[model samples]
Target: MKRMIYSMAIPLSIALSANAQDTIPPDKLYGELFVDVQMNRIFPDGKTFVDCTAKRSPAAIVEDYTKIKKAPTADFSLKKFVEDNFDLPLAPSDNYKTDKNADVQTHIKQLWQVLKRNPDKTVAGSTLLPLPNSYIVPGGRFREVYYWDSYFTMLGLEASGETAMIENLVNNFSWLLSQYGHVPNGNRTYYLSRSQPPFFSLMLDLLAKKSGDKVYAEYQRPLQSEYDYWMDKTAPTKHVVKMPNGDVLNRYYDQYETPRQESYREDVELGAKANEAVKKARYRSLRSAAESGWDFSTRWFADGKNISTIETTNFLPVDLNCLLYHLEITLSKSYKATGDLLRANLYTQIAEKRKTAINKYLFNAADGWYYDYNISGKALSNSMTIAGITPFYFALAPKERIEKAAGIVEKKFLKPGGVVTTLKNSGQQWDAPNGWAPLEWMAIKGLEQYGKNDLAKEIAKRWIDLNVKVYKATGKMMEKYNVENIDATAGGGEYPSQDGFGWTNGVLMQLMKEYPTP
Candidate 1:
């Protein structure tokens, strides 16, 4: 979930060179423009100038405008400036208006072509980052390709028989790793300090299913680089935690200790209300939450209600560790496929050790569920969220544990629409009443792994039905759905629900293929 920034369409007549040096600091550009004008007035609530990376650089905008300041009629227009300097990316064709009379599958196929973005060869200016291969964005305000979102998106591509596009997306992520030390939250310079959930290994595994184990051999280096980024033994790597039981587990952490560039205003307002001593910590927690891919969930909040009480860095999240476990297993497999027997054995041991640690630290026998462990307090978080189901997703949970956890999910988390994100109905996008596409897929597939196909099918049917209902009503797929109320749109986020959604189309298509109605 990317933050929304406002961009205004001011009309002004100014001439400037198109080849300005791309050296302007992103934070500086954001600060200067925000101070000069009311951002909401320039761009609507969900638009931002930074969102337009293909066109102009922030330094060029600021530098050129400063030169013509003496002219009485040199009015500033962000829209006109963008038009003069940048070539905007192609938008989805609007021809696919929801056919209320058509079946859900028909509309979904239309969306696959509608939401596809061709390879971007143009270099993104200083304010924006560039990717080597063409990829599909998560749609609406999210014009750039995202990290974790692409995996679920690929599932639909695979189902749609868009194998070329799937390969392209994997190549794009590999390109990001080769260029940047790690894949950022999205293809934006402002996201450089952090990354979303590490899904590169999963992406590779998915691609290998079609391409063969040889594909792993080709990507083994990038996979190792991704792992190294997470397990880096440096002060900046706050996510790697040494537990009281002497095992190394991972948590969500971000290097930047300031307000995120995209969500600047909201972060500042929240920080202003907090004590100065804890301001940086608060910002880091917020950024860490973003990295968790559940940006504002109460699962990270100390009070489970207030955003300011977010303490993401304090806990060793079960989901993050589970992901790392997958990475280790994938790496081991890759090494074995490449004939590196010693390396494969080493990673095999690492994966086994991580599996043991996860079960030991995260599982709460009394509750019959898994929860994130708070390292400082040495207590498990009481919140019941979709994250508890991740162990089953990777086949790490024992049969007895899976059976107990499945019962708890059906009893507590299952709603009429699908599995709710969390049992607590806190006013956060990742909390109850809201069910996200990725989590829905995770819960369904995780249950299916343990031969709980009946429950999995039920969850899939309800979620797909909810998606179809919303698309029929609005002619658009949403970032998240209100599973609690099928008729109402999802709410409780910094911005309104977005359309042109990538993962929704992907997950819905995959599920429909898996569990089609007779």
Candidate 2:
């Protein structure tokens, strides 16, 4: 039996305030335009105008619209108005194309060149916020450098021997940390309120390993700023949980409960169908799940099937805590590098305590799996997902526990193509049948940590095979693969599967280097 119970006493008022802060502002310029266009010209298929809207203030846009309407010519073009007021997000680059005859490695290297983005343009109405250096985008609809996605992308960059670009990416993230106090999920102003997984420490660590340990000291302020952003109690720290034992663990959380600016229509519809009392909570949870980088998974669902039952904020996700544990360890190392042993020891102690608490609360001994602890319910979630293997990736688990987890994963989670995101086929993009690049990498590397080499190789081979098959058939690398039915294209989520796929290219390249074909 797990000794830790979900006995944290969170103030309801604080929770409500946090939710309020996360909700999209009713008077937001683009949000109002989204509702107007969605209601009138553009029906809610979830993509259309929402993706096209300028990230500007609604009141100002409304005033502009009203003035345009009162003009003598009455020739107001919404597109022109948007162009005049805001900078649009990046469109897909025309330079790159898949050559079916080219090998996957060549195609990936070409794609990397095509996906590189320069600093944001210094024009009004532009959605891109300029970074200090150029960076690689994930491709297709994601034309910006995503937070966690960059780390995986960096792995491939390193393998490709593009060390300079890797340093550029690190600088970009550090710039973000200094300017915004934390890295938003992405670079757009719309992403300011929330952050994705805290991987900045890992990013710095990678740079240090390649460059030198002095890199840690150089980036210490931004690293500490990032940590402070997560630990701040007011509004920035959304997912933090206080344990009954007076220790703290983190969870996935977002600031806005309103429909995401990108997925406005879908979020609004889901909110409409939800029970009114829990609607805001549900919406916020959905947004929080997005922050987890596993946007819509059965792991966050109460019923494991529908969107209405999403309660992401109520659970302390195992993967998130594991990442933070690594962050604490990194911080300790960074302080030690700077000759601050007292601060180093403090962070070391913090990491150790968190390790104990995570095992106590999240490890399901009876099932031999690590589950996300449901803070509100005081129990382990039933979902079996690849996230259970993350602790092993970070070498956080004991050898015996890692071996037990490997057995369970091999027996239950491994699929025809690769490891599925979760066991349940819940019609969400992050569920079974859909295998993402990041999770596959995590599972494979985690297995390798425990001498499960054969199993890791098998997973890698199958995943590479699936990637090749899809690329061969479609002439494009995808954001996610249909692991269940290799022949069928992956489906589900707010939109159709995207291409340009930064992490996909990265992980595939890294795996190819690790297990070259004979």
Candidate 3:
């Protein structure tokens, strides 16, 4: 890890830009102690220790640990050692009671406060990276503001007439961009190695809709910085990939080859039988899948079944590229609004080039759906997931292709409650039987963009009904739903389905506004 000093007194922007703060991940901060705690199951969740704040200075703690471990001590308990050395991460409060009698919309509005977090103060040894503005977290185990999740969460904020909160979300992300050159998956030292998705431009677009085009002009540099981070020609393997046809695109990747600090134990056990090289590759795939925001999804798996077979870094995702296309277009418009016509045209040209590459490489004519391009194998992934509709969602698909894609969504992907995430029931949360709010919103908006109102409204209505039903029964919103069997709980991930869900609240409110109950 890079050597540096951290101070609460120093301005964050200056501290980061001047290289005064070391952003070393938690695993390295505690060294072998981190490995021992994780491997020995000292905590049920690997995230526990990583999120803990050291009771003393890190140097002092490590020094003490070295001495203690080396000494002839009897009955050395790893759990006791960890508890003594660190302040445990606080579990999300279960104090908030459910008002099942209230309307779902009213229930959601109340949750905004329950899920909201105020501006943070910097703690010397905590993983939490303080944000300048107050923001909403995804709730449950996720106490920090997430990247892509915020975009969907903001949709609800907008519908709730909480425009100020939306602005705060945008400001916090921009601040992170200024400090770190890119937004991480969330505001934590452990998340620094990867970003969820490039949704900063979309967040700006949401704020602009309320505050006007000047919002884009205000965030121009951060937008460019985000784009540059993803399309860095200097490190092609990190995020960029050149297609066999010579077009450049981005892939989800993390520079770190070690197991994720949050899911360290699970990853290590999964790759335990593998060789060193294979274990490293498994770790990269796992981390890259996290970057895609569909961690452990069959969409990333080579065999379309086991999480152990995931090859996420090998394929260029359709949804990611579509988001980048939107970013490029947004940048072009932002530049044009600011009277920088030269740069505006340049970005427009860049978008056009990407648009061409996407259609050429990602779209499979046989199925009439966009699929991830496997840059490693020089073929289309052929894995049909809800992500296939991303081009249509962005309104980038040709008119002819839109109809066919919509047909596929209606026929194959749609379930009794809503659209399933994928056709394959791979026992993964991002696969069949589970439908996420953000994807439902994307499918609805995308179909509506192509003038397919009936289909769009159907999806909105079904999704809204499912959300309402779940809320009625459980008195809480969920992160994902069992669209195939709404009566059963959503399953198939490392963690349980979280409630106080930010995006579910947002998407439901937005959809309810459009497709009101009869």
Candidate 4:
């Protein structure tokens, strides 16, 4: 196994001791809070059972996480964990408080009732039960059984002591592989074009521990399909014929293609200092900051068609390539696990080639940063975006390289709370001054791998503290944060962006649990 520096290192401050599955009371709980609590499961190592309930019967209301650990070191109770962490068994809450009669417990019970109905799909958070017809959404469309969000969202869900739900999440990921080539980012249209942070391999790792069934052949097909889609199939053809290099590249998906409010943020920033002669040329070349960064701008230029973000420049991205390298390795393991040495070797060969190509084209030893070279033989070597540090995730760096990169992260990009979106802070939401969930996770984990523990912990804690601060004050989990300036709102991009972003909430929940104070 590849050594993971940041892999599940946090101490379990509130491990579940005892929890039982009882009935959920719909009338007693707030629908949204109810679903949020039942999203994931946590338990003590070795224990017995005490199946119980929260509200009334007919609906699923979980009372425990795992049984008691009749071991030598520690002991816990799931019900106790809920009471201590969530402040349940109190009175009424101001907004879902357990003591204030907010009925988050009750609400969670009701949400699980729905999840139990779908044995294959994993439960999700932020339950919108009995969704009003005002927004006018279809049944399946309204309550999404999202994949990427489920893992992080479960961090909070585990507070209620539900491990089975995490098991279900694993099943859902398996289903995605079983059905589609890979997992879709979310269960909604807006997220259709992309996959959320690549946590599949990790999730599978957890599920394997829980289920103890590492069926490689059953999973090989789906994993293979995902590899082919992003690595091979979806890349743009670009030519009427074939090329000698035997590689096809595609454009990274962008959302600001909406003609209604198109803003070429990338072009605007990169072209800001263009020579007078290249003014028209810059305008045409950039069109939009589609491939680099532009969170909300891509929707305007694509006639409202689906576009994830300015990821990998509408095709292969540095971070994504790094992620794919890991994915390919995992798939190769699957091949080997299935007793197919030949296929495993083939994937291993592909991984080696990719690593070589990345070092050859992306690394700028002179500047001490890695950059994406466009298909037209142009390397985006100037900008100081988080994309440069991605090589760390692939374990592709030595001490000197990572140290130089860390200096850059600290001096230029790392903010008080977390890593900045870009060094430019072009006031574009995706530019400098702003921070995002994915980059924060990537930098923190990668930094930890290289013994940058203090910095990694600081960034992760600051981000989690920010979310808790904002949520307690506003009852909202924002989409992004102004990591550059703690008091000011996030800068750059288009429109006054939404604050209650889905992935943001999920990541915050996950980090808070991962970095509990020692």
| lDDT (0 to 1) per candidate | 0.78, 0.78, 0.85, 0.48
Per-residue alpha-carbon lDDT of candidate 1 for residues 145-237, written as tens digits (9 for 90 to 100): 889999999998889888878888887777666555577788766676788999999998888888788877778877876787788632246
Better candidate by TM-score, 1 or 4: 1
3 or 4: which has the higher lDDT?
A: 3
TM for candidate 2 is 0.89
In candidate 3, where is summed lDDT lowest over 10 consecutive residues? 1-10
TM-score of model 1 vs. true structure: 0.89
Residue runs of model 3 more than 4 Å from their true location after superposition: 1-22, 233-237
TM-score of each candidate? Answer: 0.89, 0.89, 0.94, 0.60
Model 2: runs farther than 4 Å from truth? Answer: 1-27, 40-61, 67-90, 233-236, 274-277
For candidate 2, lDDT tens digit of each residue in 270-334? 88866766888987888888888988998998877887889999889888889989888888988
Over the stretch 410-430, how does candidate 4's per-residue lDDT look in tens digits?
A: 888878768886765344566
Of models 1 and 4, which has the larger lDDT? 1
Candidate of highest TM-score: 3
**Ten residues in a row with the worst lDDT in model 1?**
9-18
Which scores higher on TM-score, 2 or 3?
A: 3
